[model samples]
Target: MIQNGFMTLWKSSIAFFSLLLLGNLTGFAQQSIDVDSLEQVYLQGNFAPADSLELLDLLSVTFQDPQKVIYYSETLIQVAQRQDSTQRLFQGYLQKGNGYARLGNQVDALNNYFEAANYSDESGSDSALGSVYVTIADTYSMNKNNDNARDYYHQGIALLRETDDSLSLSTGLSNAGDFYYGLGQLDSALIYFEEAGPIFEALEFRIGIGYYLGSLGMVYGAQDKPEQALEKLNECLEILEAEGDYYGVAAFLPFISDIYEKQGKYRLAVQYSERSLDIATTYGLKEQIRDANLQLSELYEQLGDPGKSLKYFRQYATYKDSLSNIGLVQQMARLRTNFEVNQKQSEVNLLEKEAEISELRQKRQDAALYVALGIVILAFMLAYGLFRRYKYIQRTRDVIEKEKARSDDLLKNILPEETADELKEYGRVQAKKFESVSVMFADFVGFTHYSEKMSPEDLVKTVDYYFSCFDQAAENHGVEKIKTMGDCYMCAAGLPFPEKDHAIQMVRLACDIIDIVSGDGYSEVTGFEIRIGIHSGPVVAGVVGTKKFAYDIWGDTVNIASRMESGSQAGRINISESTYLLIKDHFECEFRGMVQVKNKGMMKMYFVKRTLQGAEEVLLNKTTETGE
Candidate 1:
C-alpha cells in the first residue's frame, strides 16, 4: 500500500540505534568514560595501547563528525595492529566504513567494509561477521542497491541467529524490515518489524524499541492507518529525542512530513520537512539533509511557492549527486579485496610454503651465503608455485560447486525437494495421508517375454531410455515418480504436498508417457509399447526404511492404479472414474461403461485421447480465428 509516488521522505531508513546493537557496548563505554575526560587523557598521551584503542573506539562512534570518526578509527587501527587484536582491527575498519558511509563516499565505505570482513574472518566470530554483513547491507540499501542489500541482510540474519547475539539478530531483522519498507513491500516489512519488536522489548533496549516502533509506524502509515502510525511514531520520537540521537530524530521527522504531504496538507508537510532539515543540518546527517530538502521542495511546489521550491530543489540536486552510486569503483575495490583475502587465507598453502622456505634460508645462510642468488631463485619458485596454487584453488572451487549442484540434483532425483529438505533438516520424513491425490502406474506391455529374447545390454538400455523419458514427462506435469518395479513405473501427484490440480497433472504425465513409447519411433527401434493407468483418491505417501529408503505411496488408490495399467491395452491411457471426472473438460475420454476390477469388483473406466486442453486452449483458438 506504500506507493512509490509519495515523497521519498528520508531516503535513509533504519535508525543508528537499530543499525548496530553491538555498538551499544561502545555506547555504554562512552557513557561510563566522559568524552571530555577521555579526550584529555587521549590528548595527553598517558594511556597504554589497549586503553588508547578502547578510547579511540569509543570516540569514533561518539562524534557526529564523519571526519573525526575517520580520524579516530585510523588511530584505533594503528594501536590495534600494534596489539595484534583481530577484534579491534575489525572494529576499526568497521568504524572507518561507517565514517565514509556518513560522508556519502559509498565506494570508500564499501572498500572499508570489505576490509573489515578480512579481520572478521580472521577472528572466526559469527557475531563479528554477522555485524559486518549487516553494516554492508545498510550501505547497499542507502544507495538503492536492493539486490545486494537483500542478500547481505539474509546472510547477516542467518549467521547472527545461530549465535547468542540476540541484539545483532534483532537489529538485522529490523534493518531488513527497513530495507523492504524502502522498496514499498509493506507486508514483508511488517513481518520483520513485528519479529524484531518482541526481542528488543525482552532485552529492555529502549532505543531499539524506539527505532523498531518507528519502522513499524512507517509501514503502517504506508498501509493508510494514520492513527496507528502517528501513535507509534510519536512514541518513537519521544524515546529517540530523550536518548539525544539527533540523526535518528532528523531521519524520522520527514516520515511525518510524508504522511502530511500525502494527505494534501502542504503547510504541515513543510513544517515537518523544515524541522527535519534543521536537525539534519545541525547534526551533519547528509542523507537526511538531502531527503528533507527534496521533501520540502516538493511540498513548497505543492503550495505554489516556486522561489522556495527552486532553492530547496538545488540543494537536493547537490546532495543527490554526491550520494549517487559509484558502482565501478566499488567493483574494482571488491576485486582487489577478494584477491588479497585469498592470498591471506590459511588454505592458500603458498603462504605456508613461503614461511617454511624463509626458515630454510635462515638455517643455510652461514654455510652458503648466496643471498642474492637465493632471492632470485626463491622469487621464481614462489611465482610459479603461487600461479599453480591459484589455478588449483580455482579448479577446486569449480569442481566443488559442480559436485554440490550434482549432489543436490541427485537427492532431488531420489525424493521430492520438500521431502529432501525435511530429511536433511530433521534426519527423517514423516508419512502423511492425503485426502485426495492422483496415483499413476505405467507398464511395458511384455517386458519379461521380450527380455528373454533380447541381449542383457539391449534390455537394460531400452528400460533406461524409456524410464528417462518417463522421468522428464513426470517432471513436466509436476507429478512425483515414486519408483520403477521391473517393467512398471509408479508415481503420484499431490502426496508430499497438496496441489489443486493433482488429477490434471497425473493425467498429462500419463499421456506424455504414452507419447514417448508409442509416438517417437521408439516402438520400431526398441519393439516396446507402454500402457498407463491413473486413479484419483486418498493415499499415504512418504520415505520409509533406512539402508535404501525410497519415496513411495500406499493404500487402495495405488493398487487401483496398478490394476488399471494391468487391464489397459497397449498405446492407451486408462483412467478410473475418479480421474476421468477431474480431467473431463481438459481431455477427450471414451467411457467404457462398467468393468470388473479385481478386489474392487466393478468400476467405471475411461480411455484418454488427445487433449481438449481445457478452457485456455478454447479461448486461444477463438482468439486466433478472430485475430482479436
Candidate 2:
C-alpha cells in the first residue's frame, strides 16, 4: 500500500510538470497562424518579405511537424538574405531555433538562437532580443545548468521590464517560480506566484490564472496544508471548467483527489479520480491519463477494492511502458550533451567575432565601437534601475500581505473558515446539503422597547456585546456561527464536516449563549433577556449575493429552529423533539408537549434545564475511554 501511494504521488507530480510546461509553451506561442493558408501564399511566385516572415512565424508556432518547421525556416532565411531585411533575418533564425529545440537538437537550437540574438542586437530590437534570451534561458534550465539559466532569466526579465510587457513579465515570474519550486525553495516560489497572480487577474486571463492557482496549490500540498491546497485547486478547476479547458481540468483533478485521500474521504477521492480519468481519456492527455489511473489504483486499494485496484494498476503499467518506449530519458541525455557542446562552440564563435571587429576597428578607426560600448553601459544601468524597481515592488508586496490578512480576517468573521476559503478562491460558493446537522438560533426578548428608550449607539453597543459573547460560545463548541440578523444570532454544527455528536455540541453552545444573555451583569446593564432554540435535521448552506457576500442556510430545519426560538419564553433554551432525542441522555429536560409552530404546525418541544449532575463527567469519561 505504501509503494502504491508513493507511485500515485510520483505520477501526479509528473502530470503537473507536463501541464505546467505545456501551459508555458502555449503562452510563448501567443498568436497562431494558419499553416495551410501560409503555405498557399508561399507557393505563389514573387512572394514579398512580409509573406516570408508570416510563413516563418506560422512554422515556429507549429509543433506537429519539426521537419516542416526546419524546411520553412531555412526557406525564409534564403528569402530574407536575398532581400537584405535584418528583421526577417532575425525571425528566420529564431524560428529555426524553435524548430531545432522541438526536435531535441539543442546544439543547433542554441546556435540559431545566438545568431538570432546578434541580428536582433544589430537591429536594436529589445523585444526580439528579450524573446531570444528567454528561449536560451529555458533551454539552459531544461539542461539543469542552473547558473546559466539564472543569468539569462535575469537578462530576459530586465529587457522585458523596460518594454512594460506584462505578458512576458508574468511568464518570466512564473518560470522563475517553477525553478524555485523544483528546488523546494517554497518561500521564493510563493513570492513569484504572488507577483504573477495580480497581473493575470488584472488581465482577466483565465488560463494564466488557472496555471498560477494550480502551481500555488501544488506548493501548498507539498507543505502539507491540505485545506489550502484544496481551496486553490478547486478554484483552478472551476476556471478550467468555465473555459472548457478539459486538458487543464484533467491535470488538476488528480491532485485534488490525492488531497481528499489524505483527508480520509475515500468516496470523494474515488469520485475525483474517476472524473480525471474520464476527461483525460476524452482529451487524449497521456500524462494525466497515467496519473489518474495510478491515483485511482491507490485510492481503491485504500478502500479495500482489490479487483478495481488491480485493473487500474494494469492500465498504469501499460501506459508506463509505452511512455518509456518514447525515449524521453534518452532525449534528456542528448539535450544535456548538445547543450555542453554548443556552449563551447558559442565561446569560439564569440572570439572569432571579436577578432573581426578588431580588424574592422584598425581599418576604419570609426566611433561605432565607442557608441556600442556606451550602449552596453547604458543597458547595464537600465538593468540596475529595473532591479531597484523590483526591490520596491517586493516591499510593496509586504504591505499588500498585511492588507490581505486584514481582509481575510474580516471575511472569516462573516463566514465559516472553510466557506470563507472557498469564497476567496472561487469568488462564489455553491449550496451544499448536509445530511445531519444541528441548527441553533438565539433572539433577544423585547429588544424593540429597549431600542426605543436608548440611543442608537447604546443599542448597537449592547447588541454587539451580547453577539460577541455568543460568537465565542459557538466557536468554543466547534459550531459554525452562520450569521446574525437584526436581534437574532444563528449557528450550526456538523458541517462543512459532519460530526456524530452535532446535537450534543449545539445544545452545549445554546446553553452557553443563554447564560451570557441572562447573567446578572447583562440583565442589569442592558435590561435584555434572550430565548434560544435548537433543532437537528438537514440543511443546505451557501454564500449568497455578489456585492455583499453572506454565508447562510436554508431548509425546514432552519425554519423550525427559528420558530422554536420565537415560541419560547425569555431566559430559557427550547429544542425540537428531534434534537431532544440526541441530547436527552446528556442533559436534564422537561417535556413541553406539542407547541403550535407557525409553518411547522404542531411540533413536540422540550426545555433543556441543564446538564444532569453526572452527565458532564460521564461525557468526559466516555471521550477519554474511547481515546477520542
Query: For residues 381-411, could you state the per-residue lDDT of candidate 1 as single tens digits?
Result: 9999999999999999999999989978988
Candidate 2: where is the Cα deviation over 4 Å? Answer: 1-50, 62-123, 139-145, 241-247, 274-284, 290-628
- For each candidate in turn, the TM-score is 0.50, 0.42
- True-vs-predicted CA distance for residue 30, candidate 1, Å: 3.1
Clashing residue pairs in candidate 1, if any?
Answer: none
Q: What is the lDDT, from 0 to 100, of the residue 5 in candidate 1?
A: 36
Which one is best on lDDT? 1
Q: In lDDT terms, how accurate is model 1?
A: 0.79
Q: Candidate 2 residues 287-338, lDDT tens each?
A: 5676678778778889999878867876766665455554654444444344
Clash number for each model: 0, 0
The models' CA-based lDDT, in order, is 0.79, 0.76
lDDT of 1 at 495: 63
